[model samples]
Target: IRQTFPSAYFIELTVRQAHYAIESTERLPPAHLITWVLPDYIQFPFLGGGSNGFSIGVIPFAIIILALVLAPSRKLFSFLALYLIPLGFTLSIPPFSWINNYLPPFSHMRGNLRWMVSAAFPLACLAAASIETFIEKGIAGREKIMRRTARGVAVFVIVLVFVTLASQFLAPRLIGNEDFMGKLVDFHFRGRTATLPASHYLEVAESAVRDIGNQLSFANAWWVIAILMWVGAGGFFYFIARWRPTSKTVLMLIAGAMTVNVFAVFSYQYHNFIPQEIMLQTPALVNFLKDHEPNPRRYRIMGFLIGDGMFREVLVHSPMPPQELANMERELLVNNTSVFWEIQRMDGLEPYRTLRHNQLLNTLINADKAGYIFDRENPNVRALTLDRVDNRDALRSVTPQEKIKDFLLQLPLLSMMNVKYIYSLYPLQDPRLTPITIPRPASIPVNIYLYKNTQVLPRIYFAERPLFSKNQGTEFLLEIAEVNDFRHTTVIECNDCVARPVGRGQPPKFVINEYRDGLLSVNTETTADEWLVFSESAMPGWVATVDGVPAKIYTANYLFQAIQVPPGKHQIEWRYEDIFMQKQKALLEYLEKLFR
Candidate 1:
C-alpha cells in the first residue's frame, strides 16, 4: 500500500494531520453524520428540503434496532461494533473529535462523513438476522398474546413506512401551493414591510402554484400505485405470519418488498432524468477551444462555470422553458468535463491534488483577499475563505466567481503555470484578458464568454536570472509574490545554488521534440549556461536527463520544474516512471504472455 500510494501515505502521515491541527482551531462541529444512515424523513419532515436524498429507511433501521435489543447475538454484536467504530470517527463532535485528532489514519482523513456508508452493510445484515430471529423465537413458539403483539407491531411498522414514503412523495408538491408560500414569506419577513415588492411575492406564489399543480397532476397515478403496492405487501406479510410462522419465504418476501418500496419512492421523488446525448455532448465552448487550440496540453484553461451566482440567477429567473433549463444544466462545461473534452483545465473537482499545487493556489487566493492585485470593487474579482482552501477541499469548493477573482489577482502566477484561456459567465474586466468572439450555439447559454490571456507564458522557457530560496515556504512565496516579471527571472528552491542578478538576456532557442503523457523531450541551444523552466508540476517519480546523462530537477516558481543547462545544444528528456505503475504493467504483461 505504501509503495502503491506513497504520496497518499505521506500526506496522511504528515501533511494532512498538520492541516487538521491548523483547522481544528476554527473548525465548526460537523453536522450529525449518523442522521444520513437513518430514515430520510427523520432529517427533513418532507423530502425536498433535505441535504441528501438517500437513507436506510425507517423499517430496516427499526428492525435492526429492535433485534439488537431483543435477540442480541455474538455475530450481530460484532457487526454492530464494526458499524459503530467507523461511525464514531465520522461523527467528529467537539471533544470526542480527539479520536480523529490523535488517531493516525483517521486524523489524516477528510470527508470522514463517508464512513457512515460502511455502517449500511452491517445494519442490513443485522436487520435480516433480526427478522429471522423474530419469526423463529418471537412468533413460532411464543404465547398467543406475544405472537399477536409481534404481528401487530410488524403491521403497524409497515403502515408507518408506507405513510412516510407517501409523505416523502406528496408533501413537497402539496407544500408548494400559494397558501404555503404566503405563510413562508410572512414568517421569513415578519417585521419587514418591504423586504421585496408585493409583485415579486405574487409572481413566486403563482410560479409555485403552477409547478405544484403540474407535478401533483402527473404524480397522482404513481401515488395510487405505490399505496396499492404497500397495501398488498402488508396483506401478504399478515397472511404469511398467520399461515406459516417460521417460513424462509416470509423473510424473502419482506426483504424484496422493502427493496422495491424504497426504490419506487426514490424514483418517484427524483424522476427528472436528462437524456444521455444532452449530458455527454460537448458544449459549443469546448468545441471552439478544441478547434482553436491544437496543443491544449501545452496550456490550461480556467472555466468560471460551476457554482456561479450569475448562472444560478439565470437558472432561477430566466424565461427559458423547462426543457431548455434541463439542457443548459446538463450541457454546460462544468466540473471534470474538461477531461471528457480532452482539454486541459486549471481547476477541477479531483479527489486529491499535490500539496505544493494547493499551497500555490491558496497563496494566490490569499493575495486576492489582501487586495494587492485586484481592485476590491472589481465585480470580476472575489475572495475565497482561506480556511476552506486546502489540498483536500480546494478544488471541490471552487466556484466561478472565486476562480475568476483568483485569476485577476494571480495573473503572473497563472501565466507562469501556462494558463492561456479563461471562460466565464461574467465578463472579466481585466486588461490581461482579451475577449474572444465565437459563434454561440443555441445550447450554450448567453453571457458565458471566453477570453485569451495576453500575458500567458510559454510551456517551456529559459531564464538566466535564478532567484534562490532555501525552502518552498513563506519566504519563498513572499519572494515570488514580489516578482513582477516571470519571463526574465525564475525562483528555484535550493540551499546551495547561487542567486544571480536579475538581468535581461536573449532566451535560448528551444524546440519541443515530443510532449506526451509520462514523457517530454526538448532540444535547446544556448550561448551561456541558464535555467530551463518547464511550466509543469514538479513532483517525485519524474527523472530528467540531459543527453541521456542524469540531471537534477529543481523546484521552480514554487510549483514548476527547472533544471540548469550548460551552453551548447542539448537533448533534454524527462520521463515520469512511477514504480507502482511499472510493476502493474510488468504484471499485466506477464499475465498476458502466460495466458497466450
Candidate 2:
C-alpha cells in the first residue's frame, strides 16, 4: 500500500514481508548491490517449470535411464522392466498425504521430485518401446548410438545433482558473503531471538537440517519400502536370467510394480494425489445437497469437495453441464481465495483500536492501553485462491462502521487463476443489489461499509482488487484527522499496548507491563502526546524527571522514563539504549522489568 497507494497515509505490512525487508535492508542503496547481486542471465539446471523438491528426486531416475540404454540388447527388456517396477509400486502407495503435509497451501508451485519420479517410467516406457522396436528390426548401428546417448544422459543427471547440492551450500556466501547466512537466518526467524548466539549460521543450518530430517525421514521411509520391493524384483529378474524363467513371469512382476509405483510416488509426493485442497473438498457437500450424482462442474461451482460415499454418488448421478464440468477446477480456486481474504481482514483488525469504543479509542489517545479485538480463529492464509465474494462476513457484521474504517487493514493477494476470470468479465454489475464493480479478472469485490455518521450516510467500496491495473477507474481519498493537537495524559509507568506483525511503522522494541503485587497495578492509559520511554542503566543522563522534579528511577541495566505530559491522558514509553538491540540481554531485560 505504501508503494501503490502513496497518497493514502495508511501503511500495511506482513510478518514475512517485514522480514524480507529487513533482509534486503542490510545491503541498502540498491545501486551498490544491484550489479553484484544478480547477473544479466542465469544458465544451467533449468528451474523454469519444476519445483525445487521435484528436482531433488530426479537424481536416481536419471541414473536408471543411462543404465537401461547401456545394457545389452538381450538384457535391455529385463533392465527396463526392473527400472519401471518401482514406479508401478509407487503408484499403488498413497503418497499424496505426505506431499500435502510437506507442502503448505500457500506454496508457490505443485511440482516436486515425486512428480519427476512419476514421469520417469512414462519416459522410460517411451524409450524402451522405441528401443524394443528398433532391436526387433535388427538395427545394429542404432544400438551403439542409443547406448552412448544413454551414458551421456546419465552423466548429465549426475552433474545436475552435484551442482544443485553445491549451489545450496554456496548460495548464502555467494549472495551476501559474510552476512548472507545470518540474513537468511534472520529472515526466517522473524522477530524471534534464538537461545544460542545470533552469529551462528551453523545453528541455523542445524535447525533446518533437523526440520528436513524429520519430514523426509517420514517420507523416505516409504521410499525405502519401495526400494526393498525393487531389490526383490531385481533379484527375481536376475535369477530368471540364470534359470531360464518365462518372459511372461518376469514381465508381470516388472509391469505391475511399474504401474503401481506411479500412484504411490504421486500419492507420497503430492499428499495423496486425491486433491485434498479446500477447493476440491466441496464436492462432498454438493453431492449431499443434490441427492444424486452431480457433474464435475457442479462440485467446482460448490467451492469445495465432500467425501467419497454420498457426495461421489451424487456427483455421478446428477446432470453436470459439460462446460461446467470443464471449469470445476477454476471455480474451486476462486471460492477458497475469497475465504482466505475474509480471514486476513478479520485478523488485521484485532491489533488496532476501533473508534466504536470511546474508552478504547481514548486508551489509544493516552498510550495507556491499546485495544485489540480477536474476531475469531483466523485461517492460516498461505496463498490466496481465486474467488469472488458478493459480501464479506467480517466487514459487515460489525455494529459500528468505524470499527472497519482503517484503510490499511488486512488485504491479501488473490491467486492468479481467479484474477484472470474477473478481468475477462469486467463491469460485472448487479443492479438488484448495491453493485460494486469488480475490476479484476479473477477476484470479486468485498463491498464493505467502513464508516457511518448521520450526515455522511453509509457507503461502500472494494476491500481488495485481486488483479491490479493502472487504469482501473480508481482514485483514493485519504482522511487525516485535521486536528493536529490530539489531547493525551501521562503515567509514571505504562506498558499495555497491542503488538503484532507490523510492516513498517518501527522496528519492534521491548515493553514493560508494570503491575503491583497479586492485584494488577500500573497506569491504565497514556495520552498519544506523552512519551513513555525506557533507557539503559548505562545512560548517565537518562532519568525520570516528572515536571522537572527528580524521582528515584529503577534501572535493570537501563534507565526508563515517562515524559512529555499534556495532562489529559498519556502512557509511559520505554526507550532502549542505542546498542541494546544489537547485543546481549539488554532488550530482554527491559521487557522483563516492564512486564514484571
Candidate 3:
C-alpha cells in the first residue's frame, strides 16, 4: 500500500500510525497527546521516550532558538540570559545547606533535613524572581501569558522552600516531645543492663540511630513536599496564562494542573512512604510536656524542682544494674583483676611476652571465680586481678575451711565494712555468695538460722516468723544489730510498718489495733489462746506449719487471717511454700509507736 506514496512519506505515515496506536492503548485523548507530544519527540523518559528521541527534538529546537536569537535585539537577549541564570541556579543549587551543620537542633531530623532547610531561603529568592518576571510580562498576549505562567512557577517553588524550612524547625521539636522514645530507650537500657549482656551499649546506640532516621523521613518530610506543590501551582498559572492569552483559560488550566499535581504528590507520598524510627532524647521529659495523656496506667508525680518522678522512676533512675553486686563477687572469687586497672598495675611487669596471657587474663577477669586480695592501709594492693584459680596446683595439705578463711581475709577491710561476716558463713551453695566458717567467739553470742539456698536475704525480714515452709532445706540465723550502737536486737520491721519477732521469746505487741472505717475487728479473740492476725488477699498460697502441724486459717471481715500464736514464742518455727514479697522484722517499742 505504501508503494503509491514516496518512500520517505510512507515511512513517516507508518511511524505516525504506530504512535497513534500507542497513544490510544495508553488511553490518552488525541487533544492531550497533541499538547504533550513535541513536533520532534520529547516524551517523558519513564512514559516511553528515550534520550535519542529527546535529543533529536532538543537539537532542532536549539538551532531554531539560536537563529531567533541572532535576529533579536542584543539588549533583550542579555536581559533574558540574566533572568535565566539566576532561575536555573536557584532551582538546582542549595545555598543555605553550606552552613546547616552549625544550626540548632530544632527538629528531630539528622542529616538531609538540615540540607533542605539551608536551601529554603535561596529557593524562595529564585521563586520570587520568576514570579516578578511573569508579572512584568503580563497575561494579555499569548507569548506574555506563557511568560507569566513561567513566573508563577516561582511562587510554588518558594512555597515549597518555606514548608521545608518549617519542617526543619518543627520536626525536632515534635520528635523531642514523644513519650514512646523515652519508654523505649528506658526499656532498652534497663532490660539490656539487667540481663548483663556484654555488648549492650553498642546495640543501644545502633538502635537509637535507626529510630532517629525513621522519624525524620516519615513524620517531617511530607510537609516540605506539600509546600513545594503550592509554589509550583503559581508557576503553572504564570505559564498557562501566557500560553492561552485569556484570563479565564489561564485560571482554569493552572487551577486544574495545580490541583492534580498537589493531590498526586500527596497521594504518592502517603502510599509510598517508607516506615522509619523517630529519634528521641529525654523521652520521659518530652512525654511529660505533652500533658502525659499517652499512658494512663502509671501514676506520675513531678517534684517541685527535680522534674517528673514516678514509681517507674526506680527503673529509669537506676538504668544501670547493681554493678557493685556483680563486681564485688567477681573480684572476690574469680582471681580476675579490674580490667580498668590493667595499665596502672602491670606497667613494668615484663613477666610474659605472648598476648596469650593477656587473653587468658581477660577470660579469667570476666568469669565468676577469680578472687581479689587487698591491703587496708596500703595505697597499692596486690592480687591476681585476672588469673583464675589454679585447680591443678591445689595443695591437699590445706583444709577447705582454711582456704575459705584465707579467701575472706584476702578481701579489703571486711569487718569495718560489716561484709567480713559474709566470710564466717562457710560454703554458701548459691552462685552469688561464698561462705566461710566463723569460729565461736566467747564474748559474742551466736544465733544461727540457715535460709534455704533459693531464698535471698530480702531487704525487709518479717520478725513475726523468720522461718517459713520454703526454709525446708538448709537455714542460717540472721544476726540483727542496731546500726548506731551495734547492739543485737530480736525484732525487725520492714519499711512499710510491718513487724515480727526473731529472738528467743514472744515479741511484745508493738501497736494497739484501732478501727476507723468500721467496727473493731479481730481474727481470734486474744483469749489466753494465742493467735496472730495477718492481712491476706486470698488463701495465702503458702500455709505455715508449726512442728509439722498446720496452723488454723482464720479469715477476718477485712480479709485477714489469724494464726494460732504459740505461747511465749518459744522457738515455734513456721515456714512458707512461697517467698515473702517484703521482709518482716520485729518492731522496736520506741520505733513502732512513732511509725504507727
TM-score of each prediction: 0.73, 0.27, 0.20
Q: Which candidate number has the best TM-score? A: 1
- For residues 374-432, write the lDDT of model 1, one tens digit per residue: 22333432233222334222232334455556557777877877889877666778988
lDDT of 2 by residue, 378-424 (tens): 35211221011110111112221222222112111011001111111
Model 2 residue runs over 4 Å out of place are: 1-207, 215-220, 244-246, 266-596
* After superposition, candidate 1 runs with Cα above 4 Å error: 9-62, 93-96, 138-249, 262-266, 269-272, 310-312, 315-332, 366-407, 444-446, 500-507, 579-596
Candidate 1 lDDT score relative to the true structure = 0.61
Which pairs of residues clash in candidate 1, taking residues 3 or more apart in a chain or in different chains?
none
The Cα error of candidate 3 at residue 388, in Å, is 35
Error of 2 at 484 (Å): 15
The whole-model lDDT of each prediction reads: 0.61, 0.29, 0.30
